[model samples]
Target: MPTAEEIRRRIIEHGLSIRDRVIATMPQRYSLMVEQIRSIARSYRGDFDTFLTNLSSIKGLDLLVIYTALLAVLSKHKSLSDEEILKIGDSFDRHIYDVFSASKARRALEEAGVEKEIANDVISGVVKALNLINNKYNSPYLWIAEQRRIERFENSVREVLFRNEGGNRVGRGVKLFLRLFIHDTNIPLAVRIAYTQENKKYILHGDMYTALVTLRSGAFEDVASITAERVKARVAKRLLCEAKEGGARCKDVVMRLESIRGLVRYVGKISGDPIVYERGAYDIGYRYCRDLKCEACPINDVCKRYTFIKLK
Candidate 1:
């Protein structure tokens, strides 16, 4: 088995670009994107939880609905500015969030003083350009889920929402936004960790993987199981915890699955939490690995990807 010292060393070697000084363009771009997202989220000033908690309240979830709907539209396309999204929202139906159809977008654009032909062309151009940019960023759809996952997530979301609130307490806009945003297959593994595991800490995908690797580097079944024993152990552990005085319960709900991924990655890392692997990879890949900047890296000698291919 690897010693505690070895495991700690490996953990330290992880995220070389992030922890080390290897200033590059991609990381700088990601930094700016993060700053912009923080600026945007801070504008909300902590009211999202209230909107989420009270679906049918007097204020209705109008603001949250609008923002998330815009997110649904803008997520795949980053070049489109927040102002453009707001303008599109100005003409949006607020209810027609099912597909975020190009037709709907064109109509909205036309309403926003754009010529009809130009609106169609603009939407087409935006999608094409974003797809091209993403390919450059991380070889096309590095983080997005496959189509099958999307379908399953849509079904799962509908079932869970119906089961939880019986379809009455929740707002339709919330449901639509959730369906698009959480589309089962597309959800990140890190997000599922935070949700199903009910993890109290902000452990990124890499942290979870690091924990597993650290535990399983040697010895059979020392920390991993090849049977149903693991699930049972977790449940038993939880039950035992609940048996304690006052019992253990989730102290705070985690961030929404629908929140901005890049921002989450950036913010989580800055605060010394696990950042999502794919998002972090996107930053590291474009900034350093793609350029083969090992010489500039402080921990290059220990980095696992020291010999990784340098490609765009």
Candidate 2:
């Protein structure tokens, strides 16, 4: 098992990685974007304490679409540009998918001069997959002790993709939905006690959830598999629960987030960033695993699964 120190280092490192990308265009205006969002949250509620009262009330489709698009791109061994995403959504919002087909979707992209074979990234594939999941389970409050129902939902996602000619990898799609819902704090507990017991030869296989926990845990030198790290998260979750962080959800939220820095100055306390593992796990896939090569990944040195990228 990896020590907590290693994991904490990785969390900071991954946070830095994301921070770098989100503000790459400016003169690297460095800030933990959370602090900024927190500031917005604070002022909106007239104070931090009041914000927690309406944490779930401030809702909209804007954050949902952005999050869903990220998941869609990471769902396969493919990537999508912002323009490609806009075209797909625009086509749909304009009802162009009324005659939806691979060719028709392809034509729309072709008309836009997208020369790549983007059937999966564009109209008929990932877009449709996302819409299906959204329509079937469009809950801002998605969660389950209903393992059978969740399993049925997962199976239906696969069935939808099979019929729509989307990528047939059910786990990837299911995990992506889980990531998003958990991210928005819909189902936090599932991610913890999260991975299956069976270990894969590589981290990305059956253990992607814990693999993420390991990777986001910047100091992940000692862990054997993602499963090991997940075990760690389960332990951490208990510590959090015992500590009573963020009330029942183990993460307090603010309708209006303020920046008081320490726990005392704020409106409420939260469990250390809700579902950081889920968000980070999918991020590793989206950012690194798609075009996976040892040279391209920053944590490549520590990931034992790959020995040589430039194999002759």
Cα lDDT of all candidates, in order?
Answer: 0.33, 0.36
Lowest summed lDDT window (length 10), candidate 1:
19-28
Candidate 2: residue 103 lDDT (0-100): 54
Candidate 2, residues 1-312: lDDT per residue as tens digits? 434444444443554455222222111111222233333343442433343333344343223333343334444533434455455445433433223345555554455455555443544454565466557655322222112233453445445543323442445444444433222223221221222211110112123333433433333434445543443464456446647754354432111111111211110111133234333433554566544644665555444332111110
Lowest-lDDT window of 10 residues in candidate 2? 260-269
Off by over 4 Å in 2: 1-5, 12-77, 81-108, 111-152, 162-174, 185-275, 281-312
TM-score of candidate 2 versus the correct structure, residues matched by position: 0.36
Judging by lDDT against the true structure, name the best candidate. Answer: 2
| Collision pairs in model 1 | 149-185, 153-184
Q: Please provide, for model 1 over 103-208, each residue's C-alpha lDDT reduced to its tens digit, 9 standing for 90 to 100.
A: 6766766775555665655466444534453454331112211112433443333332222333312323222334322211222211232233222232232222
CA lDDT of 84 in candidate 1?
Answer: 53
Best by TM-score: 2
